[model samples]
Target: MVRSRLYKVTRGTLRLLSRPVRRAQGRGGIVLEPYRGYGSCDEIFLIGRVFRQSRPAPDADRDSLRDLWRDVGRRIARRAVRGAAVTARFGGTEQRVATDRDGYFRIHLKPRAMPDCADPWRAVGLTLDAEPPVEARAEVYVPPAHARFAVVSDIDDTVMHTGVANKLVMLWRLFVEDAESRTAFPGVATLYRALHDGADGEQNPMLYVSRAPWGLYDVLSEFFARHAIPAGPVLFLREWGLSWTHPLPRRAEDHKRILIGNMLALYRDLPFVLIGDSGQHDPEVYAEVVAAHPGRVRAVYIRNVSADAARIAEIERIAAGVTAAGASFVLAPDSVAMAEHAAGLGLIAHDAVATVRAEREAAPPEPATGPLPGVLRPTEVPPTVVIEPEGGRRL
Candidate 1:
């Protein structure tokens, strides 16, 4: 009799907890239930608050906000289910399905139409019933074949430009900054889009390793959508708060290196491409990766966020290490420069090599006099002698 009474109490408690869990899972009237009907389609799970604290009357309260959320989710579902018609320009030329009675939606993309590379693609189009019609979007990038080419990217400056070293600033940038307020680096979207689109829509995969924690996934997803950047599975360092005191549970650089090493081991057969900015320890981290992986790294693209000569030199050294290991290394001022460099290095093909060469040869050049000045003479200099030291010591 005692055991049965205890079991009944436990059951009652579980039932009580389930209500909150279900509500927490989705109280906005649009809940995306997993495994119901999402099969072989690109699925995006949306979860967020639907409460307005500034409303005047009680009737114009949280429930009203919830209704708005449901309406927006449903509208987005309708558009996503009709895929190609909405995202044709962004390379979404396929059909999708919407959840029945639930707030779920699935986009059934053809294998070839899906982004095979790590670059982001316009995965979904959303419209919310706001004063100006709130537009919500989703970005997605499928993993590459063979699981090679892990993508190591910086979180703050490279992606969002939040002063990461400052905890308060980082928090404000992440929490308070809305989609309309954020700005992407010039040409960033184009470069990443090209990479995601790949050569003829087929290329290697990418892994995003960032210093931000998993809590930023939603915001990051929205950011990618706003910027038209591609999305990939992200590995983030744990943040401090409920579990610890420091913002990051471990040293950020060390955490990244450890995760990168583990990933290297996990995808031993594949090569990696490290992307970062000059603001932090990316140089050291990438150097370590190059040393450890040797030929396994395909390239390193370091964004020049700082004009510091020492920092630039360090990045060059890291790039040199990658180059020595039979991979390419590039330091670009912006995404356009990176794209040009990538094309030059054959990492991506802007056009057929023969076609480009032919075009170059056919193009006009400056008319020359019979003999140019000595200073104007074009001479071939050996690569080793290009960066000679003051005393003639080769760099």
Candidate 2:
């Protein structure tokens, strides 16, 4: 309770201090910022935000110091307009919803007509029921009927080199650094592309999930575009509250498990390949999801990011259970290692392994200089070998 109050007061003070800068940005009509959404044919889910602005604009390119400053200012200047009435329309279906306290609105509509999956995204129109009525369109990804499997990957340590275990380091990397300055794990883009284009040439759905807050969405989106990582309709991020007493909605494990569960339910016919790093609670969360759903998970990949003996041992035990429950669990040392295993399971083509290895070998080596004074360095454990079950080529 005390922490929550302190955090709220501190945030309020900061917002008050920035009022002039925000006001300088604009003083105009309402703006509807629609984020990409996804769902199946029977039901559609869409989310967006309402703000007081002339129009929506892309974040500034961060190639220069001035550009970086402008980008940061734009992000901070966004102020949500609460209690706005919004309507979503698609295929003769119209639904009304109101913005929450944070100026965000979510719409759930079951279209009367099934959308053609010839294209993955179907557009939905959005209108704000306000003066000078604002409007926007959202793209919702609906996978083809033939999608063999889906890939859900973590964003922080798994795809990019964000020091998430250390709060200060993570914040510095997220807010202070530009998109071009951020680094993705070597060959991660190649491996993810292979998974996205499955062995049979089916376009599998790739969804990125992260524990990072929504404030970093634009930066992360730019990071993916800069690095050529596979794009998902939406990057599932939490609104990490300012309330210190309840900083996050729930334990990280439960929050992730619930999201994965929702995905499983949304795509009932597709088995999932779950990917994350060992630095956080992903092993436990992915293990729980695998155990609960049994054979619905085709494989589990945990990047070897922790040198802690206890953590490694715990993950190994968890892996044993996940394997016993009919899923392949690999604590991979690098992107090529996971690529090789995916090839063995026929998830990706055997030739893709060479491509991944080449990409990995071509990546620049990390700088030898250590972190600045008092900065914590990341610890990584060696990869552990996994014994595949007999006839484990498919689930």
Candidate 3:
């Protein structure tokens, strides 16, 4: 409690001290910022911010680790979120919503009809009505009406090499490394592309859920682009709230479970292929999703980050239960293996397996390194926290 409180106070102090510099950069000016959002046939969820622009835009060419850091350095300031009139227009329907005090706004839509059958991606135009108006565009991916299944993947370790259990190393890789220099698990991109484009070549949505802080949103998005992985909504856990006086949510597991559950609920009819690593509580979190929403999860794929026999057994136990509950639970050693498993389950095309295998074979070898800390157990962590500098916190 004391640590969290002091953390907030410190961040608040820094923000106050940096206000002048940020204002000079037009952060004090009105702006509208939106991230990629997701939706189903009838419904859409759009999230974005309306605030004074705190940091100047970074170079769009920042696709490498070093170049990405250049942009990160440029965006060193922060701004307070303040409300504004935000609007979303699609399928001839326009709806409006107001940003929260934090300058975050979310809009929900029920389209009268979707786009033509040939194109599955929907473009949503978002604009903030304020002085010197700000405008941005976002996409809403609606998989084909008869799409067999969709994929929900974990970012760190599962797809990318983020040492989530080791906070210090995770922070370094998360912020300091650029996408080009940063390592994504070999063959993972090819496997994901196969899933996104499916065996039948139907465009299936790939939504990435991560425990990563939203501060690195740009870098992560760039990583996805470089990998040629089809992008959908990038949802992250609440920012870390280090508050001392009041209670805060603490379990990363709970936050993950809730988010995954919400996604399942939103796309009620679309079965999912859940992928995560053995590096964290994904096995437990995803297992719960499988048990709770039986049949909705077609398969649970766990990347083996730990070579530990006990951990494998634990995940296997969950796998067994998931199987009993009518889903396939795979203890995957590689992305290509998971691709093969998906194929065996008839979730993906048999030929896609060869594509993923070839990528694994052709990709450069992963630099030899020590294993990351063991995947966190559900019982081993505190509550999940959403980062909000309550009562003034400094960076």
Per-model C-alpha RMSD: 18.3, 7.3, 11.1
Residues 309-376 of candidate 2: C-alpha lDDT, one tens digit per residue: 78878888888788888888888768988999899988998999999999999998754221341333
Off by over 4 Å in 1: 1-150, 165-168, 242-253, 351-395
Model 1 agreement with the true structure over 1-395: per-residue lDDT tens digits: 97985554444333321221222111233222211111112332221112111112234233343444433333223211111111111235433343322122334344334444343333444433334333344444434453324455665667555655445645545544544445555566656655544555544444565566443555565677887766655656653221213333343434788867865665566567677766677767887877887777766777666655666666665555556666666665556555665566545568533333443345343122112222211243212111111122222
Ranking by TM-score: 2, 3, 1
Residues 83-172, model 3: lDDT tens digits: 678889877788989877656888888877776656666789876775555677877777777677888998988888877867766765
Candidate structures ordered by lDDT, highest first: 2, 3, 1
Which one is best on TM-score? 2
Kindly report which residue stretches of model 2 are placed more than 4 angstroms away from their true locations once superposed: 1-29, 53-77, 235-237, 241-254, 368-381, 387-395
Better model by lDDT, 1 or 3? 3
